[model samples]
Target: MTTHDPIPARLAALRTTPTPELKQQWRELFDSEPPPFNRRFLESRLAYRIQELVYGGLKPETIRRLERLGEELDGGDRKKSRIRADLKPIVGTRLIREWQGVEQLVTVTQDGFEWQGRPYQSLSAIARAITGTRWNGWVFFGLKNHRRTA
Candidate 1:
């Protein structure tokens, strides 16, 4: 049989405790003013802290690795230019457009665009095939527009 412990009772009380009481507990336990988080968040952190005091927190190496990953995610450690949000497309994404009652389709590839089982250097080439006229590939594919023409 499991023994009753004050830790579980405290955790239960923490959940039902008012926000102002939890903030006071937070200050007493953490020795600092509690953040302006909601009551549930406050209770969760306090519960984790209670367990951490009995057990332990994560290792230093694990903490460092997590911090490094967070930095990489925040773009703090990137060497190369970030991919443009507008140009980013996973391979196999389909681009479809209808012109002259015909549905034109193109598949995005790692290297470029593909149409009709043949790879094209640019969307403009596919657009030219569809319309037989020179056109900006991005504009023709509805990806962008001729906003800044020389």
Candidate 2:
């Protein structure tokens, strides 16, 4: 017997829904003002919320396990957890940028970053080396927007 699955349709509709309508839906679903994030974020969160409402959210044990994993990743520090979740790239990932017609490459490491045969403690330092001026490394490397908070 075939049973209708409405969750897929609900998720698909999020892509076409207008931003204001999505915000309204967010308010109703989340019981709060919609966050000041982009339309994509709204759509994605709405999709997840719709499915979560129908299928039930994660189990308490699963949630606790995820929290423990996050703590492990950030050494049990909430501030560090947020920063790492938002800013830290996977180790060994290569970040490449072009400055003054020269290509610069940086490798993410466990401790920091490696660039130009030298290890650096921060991407801003590498950006300074490449541009000879203070620059937000994430912006210079095109990893994130300047407005994003850690």
Flag regions of model 1 displaced more than 4 Å. Answer: 1-4, 77-150
Candidate 1 TM-score versus the reference: 0.46
* lDDT of each residue in 44-83, candidate 1, tens digit only: 9999998778778899999999878766654663532354
Local accuracy of candidate 2 as per-residue lDDT tens digits, 30-149: 999999989998998898889899999999999999999887777797767667344679899999887889899999987789997889999999999888999999889999788968
Question: Least accurate stretch of 10 residues (summed lDDT) in model 1?
Answer: 77-86
| CA-lDDT, candidates in order | 0.83, 0.89
Worst 10 residues of 2 by lDDT: 78-87
